[model samples]
Target: MSKINHFKGVLFDLDGTLLDTIGDITYAINSALIVVGAEPITTSQCKGLVGRGLKNALKGALELKNREVTPSQLEELVPQMLGSYHRHPYRHTHPYEGVEALLDDLAKEGIALGVLSNKADSLVQPIIRGVLPTHSFVFIRGDKEGWPSKPEPDGVYAFSEAVGVPVDQLLLVGDSEVDYYTAEAAQVDVAIATWGFRSRERLLEAGCRNLYSSVEELRKEVFPWL
Candidate 1:
């Protein structure tokens, strides 16, 4: 197969793309749900809820429990979940197989790296530092006041600007339709990591192309020089 290696920078999605954080996220969500008298959801269910953002995840969890809450109520519940998550963020979270080696190789190739997630900025920063301390990223951004979330190009543009890479030269690697749409909106190249929250079939169903089954596949196909 022909190699594709035109990108100078990569923007990764945190939750499913680089790290498998469903366990801790599920724990936090369940903790908040139980406190609110709502039924707790399974880890499998939580996977479908995440990648959008914590608020959305919480909302989805409540829906799964057949409970509905107003926006104000949701706002209040988010902090509870956040507190639970902060207590033990990395309890079961870790980078995917071959992810560290991929990052190391990319860094050596002088490829700018950045992480952008819909997860809270406070949470995203610590997770990366704690989990992948060896790798240096140009920026690690997550949801915060005034910044729009993924599928909205704003974060993607910001990442491009921060890393000093043109949008055309940047590749957004992620594991969900949200990521695919984010790249589409930003007009940047996108490669979906199927080993993430969504399966290859699910991503394809969502109209995602350029799918890679693993970090190794991605490295070989997108960054052959590595």
Candidate 2:
């Protein structure tokens, strides 16, 4: 395990990796589903739906194909969900226990940190701000019109450029298959966060060999120097 000083930079997935956003996400998802006359899904169900971005989450929550969920309906549902989330983004959202301190320790070690999420920056940025009030990422971004979501290598390059680091020296940490694919595509080392939304078995199945069961575990392996 490399110490915090070993890596020039790090990139994190916002929702599942850093913040335990399942509570608010599940609430928002259920609210949106109800508005659309659809059945609500459980928190566990929401866990499977998240990490892929809002559109995909909506699809999974409603159990509908993309085509079946009309664009017009999505237009309505998105705003409803956003409004609900924005109104109470921090109501139940918070960084997983030790992650806030880990972020601080990384920053103190002069390691540049960045955040990446499938939701648009418009949504993810504020949510992160609301949750991680005591820490900050050097570069934070989410899906935008031109920016491709996770599993796309462009986001990795974008974060590297933003943080003034080379891709090879950046460690991408996330909790899903999307993160694994993204790291592979970007040709960077990735550490799977088992404390986040996904299960240890699932992340391993997704080819994530480096798993951290808790925030402290991650801190130990990635930032032992701190």
Clashing pairs in 2: none
Enumerate residue pairs that collide in model 1.
none
Work out the TM-score per prediction. Answer: 0.96, 0.91
Report the lDDT tens digits of candidate 2 across residue range 137-175: 878888889888889989999988888888878999998
lDDT (C-alpha) at residue 76 in model 1? 89
Candidate no. 1 TM-score:
0.96
Model number with the top lDDT: 1
TM-score of model 2 vs. true structure: 0.91
Q: How far is candidate 1 from the true structure (C-alpha RMSD, Å)?
A: 1.6
Q: Each prediction's Cα lDDT score?
A: 0.90, 0.82
